[model samples]
Target chain A: MPSDSSPPNRRGLITLAWLWVAAPLAYGVYELVHKATQLFTG
Target chain B: MSSPPVAPAGWSRWLVPPAALSVHLSIGQAYAWSVFKPPLEAALHLDGTQSALPFQLAIVMLGLSAAFGGTLVERNGPRWAMTVALVCFCAGFLLSALGAGTRQYWLIVLGYGFVGGIGLGIGYISPVSTLIKWFPDRPGMATGIAIMGFGGGALIASPWSAQMLASFGGDNDGIALAFLVHGLSYAVFMTLGVLLVRVPRTGDGGGTASGPSGPSDLEGVQVSARGAVRTPQFWCLWIVLCMNVTAGIGILEKAAPMITDFFADSSAPVSASAAAGFVALLSAANMAGRIGWSSTSDLIGRKNIYRLYLGVGALMYLLIALFGDASKPLFVLCALVILSFYGGGFATVPAYLKDLFGTYQVGAIHGRLLTAWSTAGVLGPLIVNWIADRQKEAGKHGSSLYGLSFGIMIGLLVVGFVANELVRPVHARHHVPAPREAADAQRQQPA
Candidate 1:
């Protein structure tokens, strides 16, 4: 077992996990914003 | 009290939020059900109201399953709970696919509404208590991160699902294929949450309560879910949540039309496209408020933040009631603010529960409290729609149609404000006895 205070190297895993959610969310927000522009434009 | 795969030494607590987001974002697709409605209605030859039954039932089931499954999730641990959510949620999509393929509306209802709703309920609460435990120092911000994904899920899902429907074609076979893709992909996505999640190791500094240093920090009070509902504080929070959700959902359900109606007779009438944009803006506000305002609660305190939601929310209603047609910007601003408060109310409550009732059985307690949401889900839209229908019958139109509804929302907000005021720390009597004390007491009691 690792020592109680030890910090494991999970930097890559964390990045991958965060990206999985963020990428799609960014896409959705982009579309939503694109659609929403019509309110001001029209 | 949770399942195994506890956070081993050296693990970063930060991984938990993404784990939670995986589940929340997937289930948050519930909000994007409207995207499927038009396609389903067209393929199934159903009217708007008939097509709506699935989403409505799904909401009801979300509350019911959450209220019931909360304790089981706490008892079995998050992994077991998350796996259950995965199975139910993914299976729901598959079943809906089968239903759509067969042209059976009731099958789709059963698949998505009943089965999938259980996934929503279980998935919704699964990460909440774990997040609170993981980030005891900043419970509001911690829970806010995970819950924010729920709001944002629709943002991603709305467009993505629409694209899928477009590419696959909106016919029945196409919709079925879309459902198949959603189920399979979501299954893959949610697996990350199940695999990555770990209950915090004891004495990790982040997981356990560091100490109850403040008078407001009643975490050491340790009330069980059963003990909590008996306390007035639970009911007060219940009323608080119900009224807030009711007030917001009323506006949200009617938003696209409400904005148009408010300005219908004015010099600047809101066009259909602008109305759609207005709905999108409200969704943005709702999603933003979940993370933004809930995190703000960490510094301001939960009670103070709620006072802002209820108090300011009531004022916004009053503004709409008295002078909605007077200015378009003012009208939109008030609606956006109310929606943010609606989302904020959801994100802040678990942390608020941690403050009053402590982390003991909090997931279960939260589950029980969600019954209030179920109540509000029906009540808010009912009050708004029924009044609008009645007003139309009375030959009313424009902003006049929603005047009474806005007044009722104000009344609900006032009630919520009072309920927030009534909330205090749970009494010592309600606190669950420590394990040792319980053992000793149990030994003395006759079998």
Candidate 2:
């Protein structure tokens, strides 16, 4: 396994963790709309 | 191959709790269910009571899940607690979608009720005890940070859900689609909480060297989760939380319709967009109260602050009820303040537990105490919606129907006010500390 070099500082870790949680959620919302459209109009 | 290095604790630990907050704040926004009431009711041609089931179920789940899952959360840690929340909350939506598609009211309740309610319970307490352990010196502030997320969950959820409902065609399909999105989206959001959360090492996580932190001044003062339940203070706090939540939710469940009715036939009647804004504003107040009032508790003490939430909150309801259909700004102002207190009541209670019960198993105790909230979740909306439905049939509308509802809320708040006054310091006999286990906390100086 590669040695993880991300989040060199505490603030960086907070930011990285936020991104980790947020990106997936934001993506999920986008996916939700996409799926919703396919269901409604498909 | 080398193992992953651990994070050197302190300040670095703040990262996980905030992620937990993000998920909680979003879901807590579900309380702003009134924001969607008109459009949903119109689209489905349903009555007020019919439209309220999802919101009621969500609150029921929040309290039930939190109460039932308290011990499991303490044993398994935040990761496990939050993982369960994501699955259930998301599945609730999927189930709700099927219900909406089939137009089966009971299915909607079953899906969101049993499935998602479990998620709410686990998610609510996922971080309480752990957060307290990490920051023994500032238990109030630490728990406040995470709980604030829950307070604000609705602030973000209200607007986003409204926009989703609007975009997805604003009918049963739209509502169904919104539920699906909420479930899937929350699962993804809460995944961060699960991924990053960790229990602090026993013995205050690093605040002390040898063992768990305890009162340095007192020779022995501790209360385990099991023991905490037996205390008068626990029951006192339970009554306090239940009464406070009931008062706030009574307004929250009916916010959209109530506000629209209050302003009916006014020169500047509330438009659709403006009504949505009213719900959004309440969300902001609810979210802000969590952080603002709860943080204030650190300085003022939980008892005094609750005196304000209950006492002042009751007074605010009086203002709304007496000044029937009064100035728009006054109505909005009083409602906002009341909603803030509601959110504050939730955010402050964990720290209240820390102050009274100690951190031995606070998360578990906090979970168990949440059953009061579950009880209020059912009672509050039932009282409001039930009365309003009865009034609607009796040719009542607008302020008249709600006048009765607000009167009931005032009585509940007053009852809560009495409970707050009855809170006294727990006696020695009631508190049961862990046995002296050669721990170093005995030698530490008190904060």
Candidate 3:
């Protein structure tokens, strides 16, 4: 297998990936909250 | 065999699951199709069934494209597969917007169903084998995270789409705008997966042990997708998946209405809004089950976990059939457990495939297995809806309408349980031989 010669910081990349996952999930939560407000308050 | 590109230094295997989640979450929006149904029917002057064609065809295409494109995905690696998924998925939305703007239902079906569905299948599988390679120690948990995103996609999309429709008006123009936004936003969202994905440097040829967690016993044989189909183990699993999905989907496809019907005669009948709440709860159970139960599988063993899913799932159905209307709490508890099993079944199967077939072409094998899902997608709903319709015609009401369907589901789960019991490790004849050392050395050298 071709190995990476210049591997960057592993922790940074993993953190960045977690941010990507969190972005949508946060948006999803936001939407859910918005819907709940509409259902209860509107 | 040529080796896959090694991850550059600092590439934590942990980064891969999030990459997989990005793609799976975006494609999981397919589950929110119900939110679009009423609006599409009203705007297009179509019936409920007509409006459902896009969702139905998308599922069929998801299975077919996954099966046919599985090898392409495996050969090219996840980056290539995710790129194809991003393009097809986004483009399908763009085209659907055009179709809606022009009031052409066929175009909606063609774009969303055929094109987007291909994206769904490819996107769904793109991350599976990669995650397994990255987290060989916890295959079930790794896949569960990504597949859990798929189960939760609807939770995000349903309300978002509903709000968009509310704001934009439920006309063709509004629908087009929504489609356009969905296409563009998801393109940007799924790009994260395409950019972040990497195949393990160890390569997928079943040579190097993925991690310390990988099962030594499973190191025995690696079956090609072609060879796998010829084995009894594959067909047995196919039946197992189909029956499990069929049983869950039968109830899920009609959750809101079925619940209301079950309690129509109660002192405080289930209202439409309340029924919608019930659907949302089921979605939560479904999402939770994917991660929770699949993670549980890693500790208990895949075969054992399935015994619970298939066995307990049947018992849950029987509970509902016998005493569903007598108490609301009992009915809700049984339904929730059943939905969880449905989600668990989906989340755990890739790892199960890894167990039986090895990681060599497990993605492709998984894609082939999804054909069972497409089959169940049709079969489950058909059995429930057809039977319910007949019961109504025969003057049956309330829980009686679904009694036969629930009994049938129990029977199906029992069959699936038996099939799960029959699974064993693949034979050595099906294993792919390890790559020659000379070939590996040559590939490692500069061209």
Candidate 4:
């Protein structure tokens, strides 16, 4: 078994995961923005 | 816990959640059913209920397929499960497109509800156990991140579908085109998950090792899926989940019209456009709550968080029933909080199951539990809509039309609150003996 320390690259992996999460979330936000613009402007 | 296949060096346990998110976000489009309802009704000459059949059937199938395919998912691993989900989900859309082009409503139901729902079921559970295994220290937060994608999927799809319907013209051809695009796009999107996902090995520092060494490991009795179903604990959770979902869906399924009706007589009356905006806000609340509230469970403990979801959720409903139309902001606040609890209830349940059943077959048990969601899907809308329709016929207007339904929702939440209180740890007899138990026993023996 490996030692009981945290994984060496744990931070990097978490950063990558955040990137993955951010992509779709950005798209969702964009959609929401568009809808909000329409709701207010129109 | 059964050991996962060894992951290679440089593989991050964090990658698994994104993989799970990919599948969830795609299948979560099921919540955007209302986007297609108007166009389907126009083209098919159907009533409101008729147009709703495809989505309703899809939910039913989601629960059924999850329950039935859960064990297979556990055995075959996430890649196999995601691949099956991708095929069924994409194919369902394609078939629905074909059905729309041919003007066969039954075909749409069959494709989206039956076949696609199978995909939803399998795909929904596919990554759950894997995630719980990967993030043993923070199961609630881990599952929350992925399932939140499911809640947010409709946010993307609703606008996208509305645009497609507008561009294509709201006829049979337009609906078919929209369906085709959804299938093709999602198939491409879901492939990312299948490729990125990997199971961690036991004691590989991905959070599974917890006996004497790891301080963060979950200490609990493990129960198999079959054993879990027979337990009173499982049934109590089932009722809790069902009631929670039923209450939320009662408002969610009718968000737009219900709000319009509620404020129709007010000085600043709600317009159709404003109602659409209200739906969007509810979706935002639903999506945000999935991640926010479920992540909170990791801090507060799953049982304590559920008390908030069921207990406070009932109070929210009561507020809405009593003071809804009197003040619009209060009504919106109550509804938003209620919706959030609904989303939290969904995102928290997998971790709750992990706490009770162990990671060995948590995905399968979660699959069985989702039948509660299916039951709620039917019951929630039926109770709310049936009462609303009868009130309309009687010429009742505004909040009065929904007062009775909200009252019923309050009752359901109370039942769920009781069920949540009744939940206890699984019995030792139901727990599967850990493989390491025997090895540890042997090692401890004196010569």
Q: Provide TM-scores for the models.
A: 0.93, 0.78, 0.90, 0.89
The positional error of residue B128 in candidate 2, measured at the CA in angstroms, is 1.3
Better of 1 and 3 by lDDT: 1
Stretches of model 4 off by over 4 angstroms after superposition: A1-21, A33-42, B1-6, B41-49, B102-105, B169-174, B205-219, B435-447
Best by TM-score: 1
For residue B46, model 4's alpha carbon misses the true position, in angstroms, by 4.8
Candidate 1 per-residue lDDT, tens place, B1-447, comes to 444457776677778899999999999999999999999999999999988888888888889889988878877778877898999899989999999999988988998899998999999999888788777787898888889999998998888999999999999999999999999999999999999987766545343422121111233778888888899999999999999999999999999899999999988889999999998999899989999998999999999999999999999999988877899998989999999999999999999998888886788899999999999988999999999999999999999999999999999999999999999878899987555533443356468
Tens digits of per-residue lDDT for model 4, B1-447: 222234566567767788898899899999888899999999989899888888878888888989988888887778888999999999999999999999999999999988998899899998988888778777888899889989878877877889889999889999999999999999988987887777765454344432211111335677778999999999999999999999989999899899888889999888777777777778888888898999999999989998998899989988888888898889989989999999999999999998887777788899999999988988999999999999989999888999999889989989998998999988888877655643454456477
Candidate 3 Cα outliers beyond 4 Å, as residue runs = A1-8, A27-42, B1-5, B203-218, B437-447
lDDT of each: 0.87, 0.71, 0.83, 0.84
Worst 10 residues of 1 chain B by lDDT: B209-218
What is candidate 4's local distance difference test score? 0.84
In terms of lDDT, the poorest run of 10 residues in model 4 chain B is B209-218
> Residue by residue across B1-447, what tens digits does model 2's lDDT show?
111112343445567566567557655656656766787678667799877877777777677667766866766666666777788878877998887777776777787767876777787787777666666555667777777776556545755777788788677787788878877877776776766766543332433322222322133355767778888888888888998999988988788788788878677666655665676567667767877888888888888999999989889988999884877778888998999999889888888887777666578889889888888877889999999999999998778888887888888888888887887766777676444532444435466
lDDT of 3 at B399: 94
* Docking quality (DockQ) for each candidate: 0.47, 0.09, 0.26, 0.34
CAPRI-style docking class of model 4 based on DockQ = acceptable
Best by lDDT: 1
The local distance difference test score of model 2 is 0.71
Docking verdict class for candidate 3: acceptable
